[model samples]
Target: MVLSKVGKKINDYATLVMFSHTIFSLSFAVISMMLASKGSPSIHTIFWIIVAFMGARTGANAINRVIDAEIDEKNPRTFMRQLPQRMLKKKEVIVFTAVCFLVMVIAAAMLNPLCVMLSPIALFLMIIYSYTKRFTWTCHLVLGITSAAAPVGAWIAVTGEISWVALFMGAANTLWVSGFDIIYGAQDYEFDTINGIHSIPARFGIKNALCFAALFHVVTVILLVFVGILSGELGVIYYIGLGIISILFIMEHRIVSPDNLTNVKIASYGINQIISITFLIFGFVAVIVK
Candidate 1:
């Protein structure tokens, strides 16, 4: 099959950004959209929301990869990534990022005036996160806040406003994501430390960093419980899901310590995939079965 130029670009961009990971925050976005619409978002809203999400996620990842290409090249684990391997050029990535962000802008404009109005702030958050790791160990939190935008934006997209419910969900997502990031970043403890990159493990030592991760996840579960209580939208099923997710979070922390990162990828990527998917499933069921 002959691939057209655009088709090749799509393939490259997909590989460049590991587009599969879009599921992470997208699950929350979907949940927020469904809850905001009382379980049935219009197809039009759903379509545009998905488009906006894909663009934002891809654009953010591409930009991050570009910014960290040199760092990635130095780290053995990331040495083979597209940017570090030179399979994708920085200029190409910049163009792709620009195009993806434009898609987000277009989608937001289609959603509502408020969404359009807030698009720049969203973009700014995404862009600024790439720099955070350079200066702060709390870069994980920055990334979480950026990731949380998915759900919050979806809620705003659906209702054309924000609420404590969206904020709660965002906070839950923030801690959930940040906790996992601390775990994942621990895998690069040596590389980050040797290179002077600011990361939880690099700054606090891996054991204490894991402690921070555990603390963050505890807050995550609490915030989620609050979401269930405060929103009154999510019901017992979502709470049950949160309970299961809490167990998973505990397992995630237990299987990996600073000295034993053997299960780090499993805890971070494999189980994390299940966590997000579970959220999507139970979140949907909570709304549908409510």
Candidate 2:
């Protein structure tokens, strides 16, 4: 009975890990390759790069959940998580984390020397982001930066060096993620405040925090536009996609208000998913047309 329960718990945790959608990280990598190669990257390169990204993202998220299990237990919104609910053991999480890290290292080694060398640093940032909430409200920004590393790392994987375009993408991702994160944090305002945790919503109240979130997203659009211009790879399809994304962004903000969080789920996951998919499609079209 004990072994069966343990197996079930592991399966549940694994499902959550999969649902975390580290594919978003992989999407950034795909975009980077498209930009760098001006069309398509070799299948071999794409395969190894994706493996590295997935391994790293899974490792990072699992470690984050493990480390924050105590905090999650305290927060109503997160109390149901596997670790917080004691459905999974700490030892199991630790072993899974180590395995994920090993997979990342192996994948990085197969990619290039630069990728291998920087893998540890990238993992460090991902790991550090999990704890930033304990210290500052800037934790959202830290998480943004960590996620932004997807494009930057992917760029390096392709060109094996840093590029201004990659930095631009990183900046866009930074703001995009920070903006949505602010929205997500709104759901935790009461919990955050009661727990003495710092967050934009906890520090500034929802209205002002949401305004800041809008500002960040505006910056995200601007940065992406700037990157497109600099690359000279964008076309009509890209602009159309941008228009849709902008509309979606506006709609995202419109749906959520300080007085009500009814639309929070729609804006955070639903609309954001659309925006990412739009960008990915546009990016692919831009490279193909050029």
Candidate 3:
């Protein structure tokens, strides 16, 4: 029974990490390679970068879950989380977080000196984002910027310097993430308000929050366009992919209304996944084809 309980706890922990979007974070590393290489980065470099991204993301998320245990226990949608439900002990999470952070640091060390130096900053921002909701509705933006760090970090890992193109990609991702996060927060509007937590939905209400989300998405697209233009690296394929992204964004919004949130999952997971994968593929193709 003890072994079985441990296995269940491990599964629960895995579920939490998966939901934290570690895969999405790794995808940014892939996109960064696409942007950095004139053609393609070495397979070894890609491997290490992916490992670092995943480890860092996992560490950040585990810390967030541990810190938010109290909040999760009070929120209906989150009360069943591993930590809140007592499926995983606090000590277990602390050890896991340490392991994840160690792995990230080691992976970053293997990548490059720049990546190694920046790893702490990236981890710091990731960890900070979870607490931002306690004080400000701008938490979503902080989370967005945290996610954006993946591509920027990857770019610096490869080039060992900052570039305007990389900054543009980061900005574009920031807006994209912020927009979707606002939509996702809609589900917790009431809970957030009651708990004195700040979020766009809690502060502005659903309808206006959705409007802000749309506006953010528009800014995302504009930034992406500028990135393509400034890099001069993308071709017709990239534009086509961008068009598809636009359509997906539109469909995502159409499915979710202020009064009806039945399509929340579709908008959040379905369309966002499509957008990320599209960016990865097209971004890679543009570099390779050029």
Best by lDDT: 1
**Per-candidate TM-score against the hidden true structure:** 0.96, 0.94, 0.94
Q: Report every candidate's CA lDDT.
A: 0.90, 0.84, 0.84
lDDT of 3 by residue, 140-229 (tens): 899889888888988887888889988988888788889998998999989999989999999999999999999999888888888788
Candidate order (TM-score): 1, 3, 2
Q: How far in Å is the alpha carbon of 26 misplaced in model 2?
A: 3.1
- Error (Å) of candidate 1 at residue 72 is 1.0
Clashes of each: 0, 0, 0
Say which prediction, candidate 1 or candidate 3, comes out ahead on lDDT.
1
lDDT (Cα, tens digit) per residue for candidate 1, span 40-134: 89999999999999999999999999988889899999898888877778998999899999999999999999999999999999999989989
Least accurate 10 contiguous residues by lDDT in model 2: 18-27
lDDT of 3 at 16: 73
Superposition TM-score, candidate 3 onto the true structure = 0.94
lDDT tens per residue, model 2, 10-81? 678776575556545555667877887677788877888788778888888889998888999998888898
